[model samples]
Target: MTAGNPTPDTTAEPAPGPESHPEIPWERLSARMVWINLVRLVISVVPGVLATAVLDTPTGPAWPLLVASAVGVSATALACLRFLSTRYRVTGERVERTTGLLVRKYRYVPRDRVRSVDSSARLRHRLAGVRVVHIGSGEARSSFKLDALTAATAEELRRELMPDAAGEPEEEAGRETLGPQPGPHEEVIARFRKPWVLYQMFSVWAVLVVTGPAFGLHWLLQPFGVDLLELVGELVDYERRGFWWSLALCLAVAYPLGFIGLALTFVMSHWDFTLVRTTAKGHPVLLTRRGLLSTRTVHRDETRVRGITFREPLLWRWLGLTRTSVITTGLRQGPDEDSAAGVLPRVRMWEAREVAARVLTGEPSPLEAPLRRHPRGALTRRLVWAACGPAVVTGVLFWLGRTDVLPDRAWLVGVGAWPVTLFAAVFSYLALGHALSGSYLVVRRGAVNRSTVALQHRAVIGWTLRQSIPQRLGRRVTVRIPTPAGERHYVLPDASTRQALAFIKGSTPQLAAQFIGEAESGGRRAAPPP
Candidate 1:
């Protein structure tokens, strides 16, 4: 085949790409991984190691510093070795990984077993233009990772492994989408807003920082002979002011600085986020990619998504903000698990519901279904449980006051908390409900930070009924629906014995009929007789 005289059409070879020639070679991780690991060690591990050295200086010329240096060097060497030993490739038949410098372990995953593909890039990896590709399977422990691949290479493997993740759409929830929907090749499902990060200003972390910090930066560095207040005074060239005014000014300055730090964290994790709908092997996938410094992309098989969870904390709920996440199987949740499952950041409640409808493919959000309130016995159960704590505290406080060690009014502290506890119990009772919505089973629970879950019927793998002594006494039972997704189970607590059985029967007709008997008039029925 000379230049201009092309090879015969049939004899022409297909493009030498991943899908075209997966037999390419046994590829090693990026060489830049060495530098990335070194940087990370310096930023994360080295500082703490050096701090430990400062606190305990092991006598002769700081042996601790030498030890820290040795540890950092050893760790960096191990990382480099790891980079050399790790090799992975994608093939038409299966994906394979070979590791272990000495033992040489070989692992293979059949193409069909590939359940999810996630790629992540932290600040160091981003600087090196590499990403860590995490390949997951239905079996939780079967997941493996290939770190330090060039971004292009990681993207290629992801496309090759998740074939449907290319340019196609699956079922087009577009028609049912009440929110942003995919159009043509532009599959933008959800786009993150910068202002959404502001919601974190009201987060528990921010509140704690403002009201009662567990520890302060000054506290941490003060041991190292650094006084933050003195440094601030010297920098500003201000003489010593009144103690209370200086303290108040320090607190005022620290509060905003703490909030700024929180805001930075939010931005680092969720800036420029997007959720898109795409296809993988003829099935639709909810693809979410986000992050500022440490970026991540998660390809969630829509088929494996059991449900959507709209979590509304007390503060967020009052502000009408909801955070959205999915109950998807084989997600391989880690320390940053919330971010892995989250489809939308804290957003308006209506917007969150709209996003839920878009992902779940329903007209009215499954969350909109009218939930049947739990029986009054459930309320009684809550009251009894809520009262136990307050009663015990009040009795202890009364005894303490009676002993003359504590003031008579000291017991009032415990008594005052009772009303708040009772109010919470009532709210918990009111929030308890379950309903069937289309192909989804909707359940709402919790007094604070209420979670409304809309679980898909087919996703439920098993049913469990537990009637504890207390539940039996109250004529109530707890029904647990187990699924491979999310927390592995969803619970409906304190339903009437009869209604629990009835709910199970309605949700899974064939399976329930084989076990649960008809409801009795007293809302109690005998268990299956041996």
Candidate 2:
């Protein structure tokens, strides 16, 4: 048998027939999803009722509205219940998921093509003792929740699907030591907190929390025939109490109150935060966490990562924090309908560089390299000059506006145009500095994140040296490497003519020499075209 072929063990049972798969208990399986959906259905009906009330539309009978809401809720609940009753089976060779009430749908994932397995349990799911599992292939992925399965069974299923120990002994199945364990130096690489939760809470009560409800109530009363601003002006008359006294009181109370609300929001969203590294199914597992009310988990295949990037915003730098992300090959497209790409979320910021270096690069240099930009001063200066046109235009416009030479009506145009130019110049400078000071592509074989990539000089699909017209006039060039996936370009936008030619020729001799070598080898000599 071929190495990829599955071998049946003596303990294996007869493969289940198409119609005989075990039934999934609908109530047990999807209780949480159903409850959540029911709550959502009720919430959705409220908006409709509110719209009806706001418009004062010709009213249907109260009973009809109630009955319609009931029917809508019931239909949605039934659909979810039916979906949960689907049965799935995984054998040595393939995975089969079967679902339907009358006409069933079957999905098959062959064992060899299965790339990764992910499992997650939200708060609600944890209460129900269930976890959602996703099985991924390079081109497609599938997900299902196995309700109330024992943890042992979940681990068994993971092992069967992924089969990490292809040649190891069967007796080692239960042992954790079968795989390479992380040393003490290794640490948690990535983490996440639900920022949207904090954002939502802040949006709802920011005004009331920051300024006392008295102020909010006053603002709220404006639509109901109250003129609080005029009343306040009269009450705080300059003739009576001094203006400075009232202003001082407002500052003393309001500013600190605003900060208190912001602090509370941040704390609540990230309360009980925990990020840890552990071995699961003989692979490094990264577990991230946040508040007790909501939890999220992401699983990654360490071998699949192409690179890791650490980003530090100016604010984060001041706070000694760094956000880390990995560049992987494949992921599902989100609901917003972008092209299929990889998942890259902002992990925790504090003490991130050390953790990221240990997990992502196998050495600490990757994170440190980008932070040291002094070595590339010459390269950065040239790039800044090449990309500074936008910034110059922006500065000029700002100067004009400040001097009242540009009309206030055109303020937005000046506002929009200046930032783009300024940002471009800044980014160009940073990229050049990174290439010179921080540049090291440590290509290695069988590293967890950075693995060896095979490239044939003769198989150079395409190459280009490009420069903007202005850049060309300045004698600059940007080298582009085009592969099947897309193009990767590096802009050395301010090299001298001799330097540009030599750099291009040296870096991409394979592509440049391919045509020349082919012509000489084939004896296809010809006069230069006139």
Instruction: Kindly report which residue pairs in candidate 1 clash with one another.
Output: 164-279, 164-280, 164-281
Query: Candidate 2, which segments miss by more than 4 Å at Cα?
Result: 1-87, 91-109, 138-156, 164-306, 313-321, 328-350, 360-364, 370-412, 436-439, 442-530
TM-score for candidate 2, residues paired by index: 0.50
Off by over 4 Å in 1: 1-27, 35-78, 84-112, 138-140, 165-183, 187-189, 207-226, 229-252, 278-283, 289-296, 332-338, 393-417, 518-530
- Stretch of 10 with least lDDT, candidate 1: 171-180
Candidate 2 lDDT over 38-130, as tens digits, reads 665876475346434543434322333444456667766675756476766775566667677778766656666565555555554565555
Per-prediction tally of clashes: 3, 0
lDDT of 1 at 233: 74
Q: Compared with the true structure, what per-residue lDDT tens digits does model 1 show for residues 128-242?
A: 9888777767555567888778877876776676654334332111111112223345367689886776777665455456444423554444545666657877754456566
The best candidate in terms of TM-score: 1
